[model samples]
Target: MSFSSLLASSQNHLTPDTNNSLTYTLSELSSLPSTSAQFDVDGAYRLLSTGGFDAGKFEEGIAEMDVGERTAQTQNLETFLEARHSAFINLSLKRSQELSAAMASNLTKASRASSWSAEKKRLQTSLLGSRTYQPPPSSPSHTLVVPSTPGLHASTWSANQSFPPLTPSTSTLSQTTLGATPANKVLWGASRTLDSHAHLHYRHTILNETSTPPDTCPGYLDLLSILETVSPNDLATTSLTWLAEQQRSIFQTFVSQKVTSSSTPITSTDFQEYTTSHNITSWHKVWLALRSSLIPQALTTISTITPPSPVLLTRLKTGSGKIGYGTGDIYRTLIGKLLDFENIQGDSPGISNTEDYIFARLHRLTRGGTVRAKKEDLEGLKEEVLSWGVKYFGNVWSFGLPLFCAGGFEEGISAIKESDEKGNVRAVSLAIVAGRRGLVSREFYEEVVVMYCRSIEGGSPRIAMEYLGEVGRERRKEHVKKLILSTRAYAELAGVVGDDGERVGNEGESTPIDLLFGQGEVRDILRECGDALGREGGGGTDAAELYAMAGEYGRVIEVVNKELAVRVDSFKNGVEDPQRNYWKIAAYNFAEKHLNQGRTHVIERLEREDNLKAGSTFQLLMNLTAFFDKFMEGKFGESWTVLDSLGLLPRTAGEVSNCVDNFFSLDKVARDCMGRVVVAGMECLFNLHASLKQDKSQAAGLTQQGSAGGQSLAQQANIDHDKAMRDIRDRGRLIVTFAGLLHGSLGGEVAKLIARMEAYMM
Candidate 1:
């Protein structure tokens, strides 16, 4: 018979009988089992193929045929059934073992043990052949299964062979029960529940475990270590939410600790290395935390982690993130810290030491040959350095000279105002230093001139002037000239002149112009002025004044003669020079000063010069000077004669008004000189008034004689007295009106002259 037919016969016999008992008793089978010779195993095999084995039918047939007598065949059949049962059990055990091993390799040890228990329960259920048998509940481990293969049937069973059922131990039952239960029950179970809700407790337990534990619920250090191993993306995927929570908590704790213990030394080497190795995108969080805890240390750490200049510049070009966070944020933060002079308190090493360190680091990071930092960053850095240097180093030039030089001249000059006198001097010195190095622009020198000239009116003009002199010594002549001219122009524009016709408050001190350019250069400048004005056909009176101030009589005379010749030439050409009157006044001042020394040549030359217009204001000034010189020399008569010739002896109100109007028509500078001329003319009028009064008194005394000849003399005296009284009244009114005009045209000095002339008239 074929194995399929035999297996089919065996299957058919496996069914339970109708009476619920064996149809044939073992006694019947025993009747034939005594002798192997009587057993027909081969014939039984043939019969096994013809009809399926019904235990009742087969037993009855065996009894009728005395088949029970063949004990050897029965024994052989029992051996076959036992062998088949053992083979089936072995196959099931092997499959279960394979599944368990596969699961053990793939899952955690706890899961693998649970899977083994589930597999054992499944094997027991299959072996028992009981309808009440139940499979274990599916779990993480139970989800695993053995891959099915052909011809491997789990239900294949033998009736004659029996295996013992599995009875689980108490501990194993509890474990299986726990695995079978719902997740909520398992978590809440008293025996299986966690000891504490704190993460630290759980973390400690995880750290203490010998097996490879999960990194899901790790501590701070554990997370840091994991960061070293995993990529930023993987790390984020694994513990992003947990890391964010931990980051906030840890940062808060760090800040609290730092705030409580301000002297604690904070370091970021580990954090930096971890973030850098993982290329963490949320590094700004870490940096911000560290900075909040300890800014200087955090900045120092970040500065080290900054990429090379090229890479940093490229990243910066990519633009900052929404919150202005980027790879270059560290550099910017460091720069801000370094520049925050007002807030940064120094260590025991002092602010300078800290500044040096910061500056060195900045230079090292930003130095990209010619390019350095980004344009905006470079400009911001320059401004910060200038501000910081000026605040801490006494001046920007002292510590940030290169940066200041790189800036605009207006910026440099504006920086000067932020400093004291000493600081300004130092700044200018540094500017000169830069100039010597050929790093300064033309605007720098120009700005310097402007600054120093501005200071001339300020309270620190002396120091400013001294510094300007030093600068002028090193600078070009044109620059010095600009300085001098700017000082002069500013003084003029600001109306810095006092009542004395000199710069206000500088009488006792050297003028800024004189101090900046020494007297020798001043004389040269005066000569240049003379030449320049002469070329322009304007008088060199300003030059003559400067020369006279230097006590250079020769140069003063030279300038006056050149100026007089120019005026005379202008008159001959009918150019109608307005400044001719001013030049003549300047000449008059010079001549009067030297007149007592018998140096009256200029006065004589001015008077004899006819091209200087016979009735012009120039001739009036010369005549006035001659009149004053004679009056001071006790030549009152000649003074009177000179004054009369110049139409100063006004006989009526019309003449007096005309004279006063003409005097005021001159330039203000010429008006100042003409004030003295008016005073001299008033003196001549006063003397005439006094002489008339004396003659009138004497004529009254003579009229009292009453003799014929005496009467005739008295009559002539009376007529002469009447004429003198009219002249005196007219002259006194002229002097007083002229004095009033002088007071109105000129300032207090002329008013004083008016008072003195009024005293003589009275």
Candidate 2:
């Protein structure tokens, strides 16, 4: 018999019989003999054919057929002609059969059910032909027969097989409903089911109306395209809808999998990945979404909010999500909405209740500054924040308040010099809190001093300093003393701090406030201030302490400048502070500790400058010459060697040489060299102009007395000299350019200028 006839005959057994003798149970079939005996038709044909032709190829074929048919239909409409409709159907069916068979095998292996029965049922239920295959008649002799050919008479068939009866009244599902089970649903098909994971479902619902099996259905790629097309209206709705659905699925899945619950909390990682994948546009949205979920305790998980976080919250308040979206666009629309909300809805006292509700649920403190509050509204915000702060962080500047305050302070201080009003206030508040709590660090004190120095009014720094001392009291006094000692230590340790090292003691040096309060003398002054504040009323409680701190301040200067006078009495000699040392010893200690021979330059320059009898020019020359000597030493390593090592010598050699030719050793050259080099340079141009005019009488021949030059031979020599002077001027300009380049290479303008001078002399 043909394979189709055998398959047809085999499935015929599914029909209920009145007599139990004619049917066979699966158990009875196991007892049947295995045979390679070829039926009239090939086994391959039986596997390929529809009917009991149940195969994996059928489902895949169904999907392929659906795609081809729909695609062809769309193509037909577009081309203004019908598709080769019959030919396309034929192709779809063929592909459907091929794919269904392949898919069936895989589904069967994955299901791991008894026999190939469940998969076969799923496949059969999915196929179009499985609905129609009918059984051939059985003989009265209790034999099963197979026909040899298609549509041939039953009389031509031979009865070959018989089976025991299937148990009566046992229910067998219809083909369609068999696949209706949730797990049996085809993915991205009209009907689908939950998979093993149970977290993600095969959602058969279509996102786009035009999508179908033959069509590429909506998926991640489709979502991405939708995102591209999102506008202020429809796209936002769609993106939000899609994201909501996705989040819902994730939530449900996670719950179903026991990954999260009231009893078993979700991890931060789960929340992070779930939120991150959704293409959320702003930090506010991220915050809202995550805040809606419970915070996970997992340390490895990191959740970040988008945007200016507070600004995002403001935008959310405005209800911009209803407006629209843009590709790679920020939530400006949302922000506008938030501004409107804050204007209308945020004002009423009733709004505080709503905000508080959210805060309580989210484990957030309902603080005023956490949201949008303009300068005028800050007081209200402050009231709200302080209430929340006391409730959540307590009245004292302890626990969460300190951490929160510190961050705000840092941000505020950073913005203060930039003239940010809000930032400055926040910084000031933070500093006060820090000082009050006695939690202030050296860095914080330094920052406070710097801020005071930058204030608009005079003595603001001193006032600020006194305020700190007053509030912090004895603790503040101790800190002030410690700060003086620290500053001394820093100056002593100055060699490592680069050019701004001196400013560590006197930071913001260019600002008048720093000049006033940041000097060593100010340390003594603060001691007095602190002692005065420490007093009970008239004289001071810490009067002796104050006097002692002031004396210690003087001692700091003494130690730093012990070498100043040659006389023995000038030394701190038997001065009370145990920390005091003689000038030579201090210098030796500084030099030895910093591990550099060059520190002596600073000492020598200070002493020579301090000695007024040496004269101002002499002092300036001494300082300049000291700088020159240090530059020649090149503590950072030779500039030429560094450039050569970097292979930049090739590109920079000419510029380097030009700078060298301009700056050094012009004195031996007196007139010629000065005229050719020094006079031509930028710094010497004024001097050059003055030198070129030996006679005042010739000034009239030129355009302006100073503006014109002489043309006579001696005048010409002077003219020639003037020309050389111009060359020197150009050289100076060149030196400036070279200095800039050297700065980039050697690290600073001063170093570069010195290096260029050295190279010029070389």
TM-score of 1: 0.27
Roughly what TM-score does model 2 have, to 2 decimal places?
Answer: 0.19
Error of 1 at 709 (Å): 7.5
Regions of candidate 2 where Cα sits further than 4 Å from its true position:
1-378, 388-487, 490-492, 496-762
Q: Provide the overall lDDT of each model, using Cα atoms, as 2-decimal numbers.
A: 0.38, 0.29
Candidate 1 weakest lDDT stretch, 10 residues = 127-136
Q: Residue 328's C-alpha lDDT in candidate 2?
A: 32
Cα deviation of 427 in candidate 1 (Å)?
3.1
Question: Which candidate ranks first by lDDT, i.e. highest?
Answer: 1
Give lDDT: candidate 1, residue 591: 44
By TM-score, the best candidate is 1
Q: Write the per-residue lDDT of candidate 1 for residues 428-458, one digit (tens) a residue.
A: 4334333432335655754664464465434
